[model samples]
Target chain A: MIVLSSVSKWYPNGARPALIDVSVEIGAGEFVFLVGPSGSGKSTLLRLLLREERATSGQVVVAGRDVARIADRRVPQLRRIVGCVFQDFRLLPNRTVAANVAFALDVVGRPRHVVRSVVPEVLELVGLGEKADRYPDELSGGEQQRVAIARAFVGRPRVLLADEPTGNLDPATSIEIMSLLDAVHRAGTTVIMATHNASLVDAMRRRVLELGDGALIRDEADGRYDQTVPQPLSPSATLPPVVPPPLVMLPPAVPAPRGVPAPTALPARPAGQAPDAERSPWATPTRSGPVG
Target chain B: MGDTDAQWPGRLMRPGPLASLLWTGLRRNLAMTGAVIVTVTICLAMLGAGLLLRAQVHTIDGFLLDQIEVVVDLSDGITPAERSALEAEMRRDPLIAGVRYETKKQVYERFRRDFRGSPDVVAGVGPEDLPAALRLTLADPRASRDIAVTYTGLDGVEAVRDQRALLDPLYRFLDAFTVGAFTLAAVQALASFALIYTMIRISAHARRRETAIMKLVGASNATIRAPFVLESAVAGLAGGLLVAGVLVAAKVFLVDGKFARQTMFPLFGWAAVWESAVVVLAAGVLAAAVMASIALRRHLRV
Candidate 1:
């Protein structure tokens, strides 16, 4: 769960703020699509949630903790609960697929047995169990993204943020990657994916939060990619219909494996209830009411 | 979940994975690692050699300073009373440690024995040709110049000579040599630090993707930096061991086997060698580790 009340981020020498007066809330077990053009603050919003960049003025709370105000030393602790994937599929070229996945756990100081046991299971979950010994260069683009997903999901994080994860893949490969993400979402991890793929966004029919020129333009439940573009004559007429692959069914609600500290699940906030301002000591006090 | 949370500190305490990471990093960058080790070894060798040479110079200085004395030669027409009075005067002087009088025959005989290899030169000299003098040893060798200047135009004195004057030029040359050695060592140390910095920067650049992934996966800054720092530390340790080997070999071969046997001057012993080696080792390791840390901090932000 995340809450951003009046979040505004500005680059020091920039002429305009990257994000301005944007406020949004995401509840637990929700899959949200962040749709925007380049420089529209989609990636910037995700970065704010990760605390990679501080909001100039805001209370960016993730799972009941104000991420912007957490100590620098505890940033890693926050990251352990919120995993991330990127468009480039940032895997170490020299490491094997299994080592690459295990690296995520290793950096968090997981024990050898846990890495040994959990890496294979996660790789299996991503359908890369047969290519465990293959290097990143040896894998196909979709497979590489699957490795990245397995690594992000291996930590059993509560929230997964992806920034254009399928940008580098073919349309068909992108669909497979989306299916993998859909399975991850089905397993109870909150997924906030930022993407430009209208077809996938339309096919998925999930909640859409659109940004334009650093402002939150729309928040729609079960929304299309764009309201301006006319809908197709038929839902599946313009492009190939997006569908989950038949073989890649992620085990439903996979429990936390040994050695990974299971994320403390926060209770989903009820609609119309105000966010608790007392928990965020560093938040600006100018606005107190919930954003409509 | 609570049990796993309680185990976090204990699990992090085990450096087993980190140690492997360090080893793998070193192995992956073998050429750079070897280059760093060689650089450190050469620099530390120069530093250790300079220190040992300074120690040897100090030892020889002490030995030679203790032998310093002033000689007062008597005039040809001086009476025995004049010679005895001059001897008594020197004995009573606070600066004079001891006074021995040599007669003309004794002086001539000693000159003959010193030039025994050159019989032709000895044949030209006679007992009456040499001057009788009082060899005046000083309480402090540094006072030789003052004593020589004091007795230069005294009664019954033909000329006064200070042995310290003869050795001053040699001491100056040795002092300059010591300073030159240390300066060269310092330059080499600077070069070593620069090489280490460059090596760490290159390694960090090469592993930037891996490091970025590590950071994304919640690795601490220390965790990301540990392998690079440990790689440099391993090279430093190797270089220090090589320096110790070089110093020990220098002591055994150059100091004891060659200089001690070939020259009458006293050379420093093993204790000095070990002390210099330890200092060089510490300096080499400390510099390498510090340079690596600085390079990582500047070039790689975890």
Candidate 2:
């Protein structure tokens, strides 16, 4: 789970804040899309979640620990729990496919036996098991991105962050990559992807959060690609409310074995009920009046 | 996944992931490896040469000091008591290594033996013509001037002479040469460090993609840094060993076998060469490691 409360970020010497009083909450096991135009703060939001940059005010929490309070030495522990993928598919050109996947495990000091077993499993998952000996340059663009995904998933992290995973791909390849991410999400990893592809976002029909000028303009359930007139609240029409159980919803919040507190539990409500309007003040109040 | 997780990397002295990374880095940056090795080798060789020259100068200084001494001649009509007093004072001096008193007859005999090559010259010199003298050897040859001044106007002394002035020009030349060699070596060592720093920066730039990947995959800062440091250190070690081989060869084949026999001044032995080689080897490894670390701290933040 990821939570940001009134988070604001301003770079030094910049005329304005990159992110302005942004508050968000994402539950576990849900795939969400972060859509924005160029320089509209999509990358800055992701960077803040990764703790690459600190929030100027308020709390930034991931998995239950307030990241702003995490010490520098413990930053690696947080990073190991979170997996990231880049737009350019950053793979070592000199290493083979198997070596690339194995590197993730090796650096964390996993046992040799574990690394030996995990590399082939992840490669096979990505359907590149036979090309384990081929260097990255030898592979096509789709295959290289697949390798990057395989590396990100090798450690079985709870959260995956992808920054424009298909920005450089053709339409067909982009569909294939999105399907792979969908498959990963189905298997219980919370996936958050940021992109500028409108058609893909429209086709996915997942939860969409739009940003313009560093503000959260719209957050929709089964949302679409483009913004339209805000639909009036249907007092009788309820939101889609199949909130998957929180990662640690077994009623024991004191495990502390995961090195942090158990994730904040989702609102306990029956299906087909309206989302707590009080918690989503921006979603309700802005729809009732002009959005600044 | 507790302490064992942290300890896993600490035991990586063998061919684990970090070791393989180091090997791969060395293989990929072949040109950089060669440059670092060559620079380190030149630096160490110059340093070793300076050390060898310093050793030779010390040996030559020892030989020259052994041959220089002070001689005090007695005046006419000197009493035996005064002569005995002078001999006792010279012998009691802490600075004097040894003192020998020669009578007029013994001096004449020594003169006859020294002039045997020219019998006519020996016949021309009588026993009365030779003055009785006291020859004093000082512990330090550089103190000869002080001794000469102290004894020149003594009650029973005719004159005091120092033979060390004849060797002044040779000592001056050796001192200048030793200082020059060390200065050159120091300059070359600094140049080698600059070259190593540049090489590390280039190598890091070339591998930026891999470094970014590593960081995304959650590799620690130490893990990212180990390969560069290890590669540079290995290059320095190889360079040091190469210079050691050159030093040993020069000592065994050139200096000991040829120069020592011709000049009759002993050159450095195998022990000295090996000692200098060890020192150079340590210096090379230390310098490379330090240079690589500094460059990485500045350039390779990930």
Candidate 3:
């Protein structure tokens, strides 16, 4: 399980904050999607989960430990437990597919006997078992990404974070890659994906969290992909338009930390409905009767 | 990881990252390796020459000292019995290796033999004013000063002389030649070390990418450098052995030539060359080992 409270992040020497006043939680075996536009703090949120950046305030707990307080030397252990697949697909170009995966095992000083068995099994898991002897240049982009994912999941990390795993693949190949992530998630790995693909998110029917201007604006259960200018919601609709999955509902609608919109205490919206367009984009989905 | 250097001697011998990386560098740069082998071979050849010359000079000095004779002329008041007794006392001294009596007549005959074919100016009269002498050999040449000091004023002696002074100038020249050879060998050895280090450094620079990758992959620095150090060391030792063999063979075949019998050139025998070769080869191996070990220390980073 991962937990964060009052986690605000900022880049070094940058005036604008990347993420402000974010408090959220993700339970074990939960698939959470962090969705935002190009500059929305999606990658920064993922980077926080990976401890690539420390919180400016408060604490971050990942896999039952306070990751924010851990030493830099022990960070690799955290990385070992939390598998990260980067966009660039960092694999040694000179090695074969098998060798590339074997490198991961080798870095942690796995025995040769163990490496012999684990390499082929993980390759098979990613459907690259037969292409083990081929070099990276011989494989297509999809295959190479599969190899990267295989490398990430070889040790079966507790949390899997894939950032843009299918940014360059075709639609079908993207579906295939998402299926692989789903398989890994089903095997009890908590998967957090940051992507712009709506069809994959809608088809999977997973929870989604949307960010705007580096703040948690709309978080919904069984959410839909709409070009919704986020406004207020009332008690009229039968099925409310669900926001993204697993949002720790927004706080007061004030200036939130990290440039996020502070959510005020408000009434919950109904399901399978449209987003209210009359209120400001930063307002909550519904307004309660009065202020406290 | 904290205190590896505090370990025992056996642990010290284990290949460190620096040595291992040097080993790889040595293997990758075969041209430099070939150059090292040739340079070491030349060095070993020069060392062997110096050794053989030193040994040959020592043996010739030994032969010359053996021929050096001490002359003791009796005073006017001394009798034949006193002279005989004095000779016996000198022979009984444990420091003497051997002593041979020579009358004035024998000295003249020996001089004629040494200076044969010299013209006597239209007459057959041979110059015969050579000294009466007792040829002496000491267990140690250093004791000659003591023997000369003790025997100078004894009875039955006109004059007791240690004539090794005549050979002093020749000895000094030989000493200079030996010193020059020793200096040359040392200087050349230093040059060889610098040459080998530069060669290994160039090799490392050429293949630095391979080493960096290995380091990132968690290979220890020792595993990377072992090949280069071993390669250069083997080449150096091989060169030493080769030069040693060549010198020994040359001594056996060339020194037995007819010109060696005509006399001025003091060619060394095979045994002399063999003994000297062993010493030279030892020196060469030591030099190579030092160069190999040092090259690794300076170059291997990963």
Quote each prediction's TM-score: 0.73, 0.78, 0.54
Clashing pairs in 1: none
Per-residue lDDT value at B73 in model 2: 86
- Residue A13 alpha-carbon offset, candidate 3, angstroms: 14
Query: Residue-wise lDDT of candidate 1 within B62-167, one digit each (tens)?
Result: 7766776687888888888988888888888899999988888888888999899999999998889888988888887778888988788888999998878887
Q: Between 1 and 3, whose DockQ is larger?
A: 1
Worst 10 residues of 3 chain A by lDDT: A231-240
Quote the positional error of residue B158 for candidate 3 in Å.
Answer: 5.4
- Least lDDT summed over 10 consecutive residues: which range in candidate 3 chain B? B1-10
The numbered model that scores best in lDDT is: 1
The models' CA-based lDDT, in order, is 0.78, 0.76, 0.67
Candidate 2 residue-wise lDDT, B1-302, digit = tens: 11112234432222588878777778877887898798789888888887877777777657656876788889877899999999899988877899988888988898899789999999888899978988888898888888988888999899897877676776687678877877877887787778778878777766666666666666777777778888888988999999999999889888977787787555666677878899989988988888889888887876
Worst 10 residues of 1 chain A by lDDT: A231-240
Q: What is the lDDT of residue A289 in candidate 1?
A: 29
Q: Which consecutive 10 residues in model 2 chain B have the weakest lDDT in total?
A: B1-10
Q: Clash totals for all models, in order?
A: 0, 0, 41
lDDT of 1 by residue, A199-284 (tens): 99999998887777676656666778986543211211111235332112212233423211222332232344332222121223
List CA RMSD, all candidates.
13.3, 11.4, 14.6
